[model samples]
Target: MKQSDQAVVFGKRKEPHTIIIARGSEIRHFTVRPWMAAFAGSAFAALAIGYLLATSYLVLRDDLIGAATARQARMQQAYEDRISALRSQVDRITSRQLLDQQLMETKVSELIERQSQLTKRHGRLGPLLDRAEAVVNGAKPAEGSAPAKPETRVELPSPAADTQLAYAAVGSAKNPFALWSTRNSAAQADSSADHADKLFVTLNQSLRTIESEQLARIDSLAENAYQTADVISDALESAGLPVDADFGKADVGGPLIAVDNPSMFDTKVKELDEALDKLDKVKKEAQRLPLANPAPGRSISSTFGVRRDPLLGTPALHSGMDFRAPMGSDARATAAGIVVKAGWNGGYGRMVEVDHGSGFSTRYAHLSRIDVREGQKIATGDTIGEVGTSGRSTGPHLHYEVRRNGEAVDPLRFLKLGKKVGQYL
Candidate 1:
């Protein structure tokens, strides 16, 4: 290489020269330079860094988008569950409210009907009481108390059904609350209320009908009683029973009636009729009771009074009569009564008791087999049991007793009375 001339190199390996200048001497050194290799390495590093950055950014973006989608799906599912629960709750509430409303309406309607029936019953009471009082005061039936006018008859029409009632009501359709959020959507609630109202009205109507029917029945009974009373009064007159002479005369104005006289002449008659009807009903009930035996042929073995106990050999008060009978003989009732007891008793053993109205009672004891049960109604000469030696008895015999208001009475008295009333019964 020339020392003084400047040399230029292109695309060629070259060494860098180091020059040292000293006061006394000069030194020079040459070293290889790799500038191109270093430049290429720096460029490759920059490109790799850029690629890494781009890949990292793409990964982050994908993760963020996936996370967002998952969150949205979860939120949607949660919202759906909440809406379903709300809808179910709303339906239940509506149904309950409807039921309550229906029940209330039914109760109200029933009360109203009952009130009407009671009012009607009371209206008939005033006249009945007045009639009864007059009859009790030894007065004859007053003139005009019974109608002299001809009986007015009314024809009852057959029941007719309403076309609207015949047709079934169409129920309302169901719609989702979500579709009309602002509007009330308790279709069940409204329907329930309407149904309840209808039920209440129906119940009320039924009660009213029943009241009317009952009133008619009462009227019929009253009419029959009045006729019976008239017959009885006529019979009494024929029998020469004493009667008030001024019974038919109105008190104040020569047959003119007084206002608000609670005690009208016919009022007493009405009361008497009602009383007679009640008595007749009782008699009919007694007659309708089932008979235990058709024929009365039981023999009397002992009389009711003081006697020695057959089993204990002690002096005891005999509260009842005794009838000797073969084992398994039928024990019959002496009168119509309800079975008060039909089982084993302390001393009597296998006893049956019957309670007649007005505190009268009869007992049959020492039976082999009980035929009647408690609460069973039995008429005169009705078989109540089979005879046997049961408790505190030496032989097969029926122990018969008569009681009045739980107190023992003479059975013979009752027997005599039974004989007296036999024809009428």
Candidate 2:
């Protein structure tokens, strides 16, 4: 061992002072005091404790990191779920609002269409009213007078007013979900929706009322027309004429359409018009028939049918009725026709026979003098002759006869029919 590697003790109280170390042929020595040794030992111990603490921290690092990561993921997931729920709520509110807006638009469109139909109906009603007035008055319209045209004026809501109402009915503002937004916005949306609902309800009710009234008016007009047509038809039948060419043969089949459709109202109006037209035709035809009395304001001296003949004093068929009148009283043609005969006959002296068409003819007999000539066109109530007791008459009277297909029938039935028709006129 080298000298430097030797141990030495030199403390005053014989304490340890030096230490030696050797390796192969080399040697080293260190001198230490008690305080130095103590300090070194403390430093070594502190280093060892620091190493142990570092090893423990390295072993637990993965678990600590995993715990922290998992906690963070949970918090993030919670935040995401809350956000999704809020977004879903907002989306639902938006969808509901949009649906409500669409519904309001649909209702508005329906109401507008109904209003248009009502306007058209009102226009058509004008001509119908005129016809009704003519029917009630019982006077033929003047010749060449044009029928009154239907009024075409109609009032409607202005576009701007409709827009304003629509806007009010639907919420005029857009709703957005934002972090800074408040719950008050949701309340506002609810309020607006309620308001729109109420507005639509009121509008629907009003439309229904208008529709009901129009339908009632149309029905009344139809009923009146039907009644008039029936009366005229009955009169024509009683006058020994076919009622009407198409009286009971109206084509009435088609697809079933909704009553609210415009075509429905138009159809009703058309039906009323047709009925009125039939009545008018029947009136004209009845006028052409021999339904009027030849002598007015005169008492019936003799009735038609089998009666005792005054001249022969025996039961015989009376083909005509006798209306007693003063001398030279005007005897009129019962209907518009062409005079077929205006001369004396075997039993009917100074007679005028009129062909009223439709296989009907009228004879005004026992006339003192004939006013109409053969082939002369004459109208109803035209002075055809003068009443006088000629040929087969008992006194100053007019003999009226109605014939169908050249067969003499009772004239009293036609007279009664004429009186009934006159009441209608």
Candidate 3:
């Protein structure tokens, strides 16, 4: 053994390895350094480890692929579930918005209906209000004039409501009465609903107020007209005459509104119309009757009822009032009527007998000349003859006689009644 072999044997030094080969008496020897031997060993070990690793990968490939695919599927399913939840939330929000929009439209429709109802009520009361105004102004319709058309300066409850209603109905670009509408957000829709509720309450209150006022006005007018009519009718009844036997119908015409079920307003309006009609008829009849003096401001030489006959100088029936007048004084008809007698008679010269309607008649006697012929229409305050002492009269005097149903009554009573109620007529 050499000293280097002894050091390697004692593990104190590195050494190279040797290889020797002999074939058919031929010998060869080669030496490998320590670094080359170590490298060869390390290469062998690396190749073996690589082979083992390759075998392991081939055996477990399917399982790894399955696990990876499952993990990916779980992640995909989780994402899909999240997307579905979000979609459902969106759908819910959209549905809520749609419902709110529908509700808003319905509210607008209700508002329109209420407005139409109020308009109808106002229109129905318009004519009655006009009539009341006429009475207030102390104006009367002509005897044969057409009924006046209804006119008013009154306005509706709210113009803003009308504009909003129009916008809702047709989605009008421009608001006719006031500001236009704008729907921007959910918050705005909610606020608009609340505002509509408040507006509804306010409109209802306004309608109630208008209804009450209209009814009150109608009642007042009806009461006044009826009172006047009643007074005139009482006066006619006190004086023997037909109240409305042949003169109740007036030549008045207008649009007559008919209703299926009448409200209080309608009832009051009808009452007011009836009262005005009654008043008109009463006035016409009163004017037609002999309620005026034949000669105004004249001293009555004799009165109706029993009186001494001036020509006979004996007790005789004198059935007329005598008004003292100078010769050639005007003798007028006391009421409107058709002349029945306009020629001289035996007791009365140049007499004019007028047949007023409703079984009433009047006579103008002691006239020299007759201006009205028989069958001629004469009005009150129209000249019928000239006063003179032509027949059975002591001097120039007028004889005015008022007869009801051919029976003479007191003319002084009618004259006094006329003085009391002429202004009303």
lDDT of 3 by residue, 1-425 (tens): 69888878787655456788888799987898878889999999999999999999999999999999999999999999999986775565456545555654565666666567667867876776776555434533333433333322445666466646444433321222121124434465445546655665665576566656656666666666766666667667776555775554457865334465436566667878887887777877788889877887788999887767787778888889999998888988888999999898887877999998888999999898888889999888899888898777889999999998999998999998877666566
- Runs off by more than 4 Å, candidate 3: 1-197, 240-262, 273-288, 297-299, 308-316, 324-330, 386-388, 394-396
The 0-to-1 C-alpha lDDT of every candidate, in the order given, reads 0.59, 0.73, 0.73
- Ranking under TM-score, best-scoring first? 3, 2, 1
Question: Per-residue lDDT for 1-425 in model 2, tens only?
Answer: 55444444332346567888998898988888889989999999999999998998899989889999999999999999999987877787767666666776776676666566656666777778678657644532222332322222224344455555655665543333321145436667777668877887776676566556555565555555556556667656756566567766668854334566646667766776776776677677777777777888889988889998788899999998889899999999888999999998988988899999888899988899888899999998899989988887678889889999999988887777777766445
TM-score of each candidate structure, all chains considered together: 0.35, 0.55, 0.56
Number of clashes in every candidate structure?
A: 10, 0, 0
Superior candidate under lDDT, 1 versus 3: 3
Q: Which wins on TM-score, candidate 2 or candidate 3? A: 3
* Candidate 1, position 377, lDDT: 86
Between candidates 1 and 2, name the one with more favorable lDDT: 2
Cα RMSD, each candidate: 23.2, 14.9, 11.1
- Candidate 3, overall lDDT? 0.73
Ranking by lDDT: 2, 3, 1
* TM-score of candidate 1 to 2 decimals: 0.35
Which ten-residue region of model 1 has the weakest summed lDDT?
A: 162-171
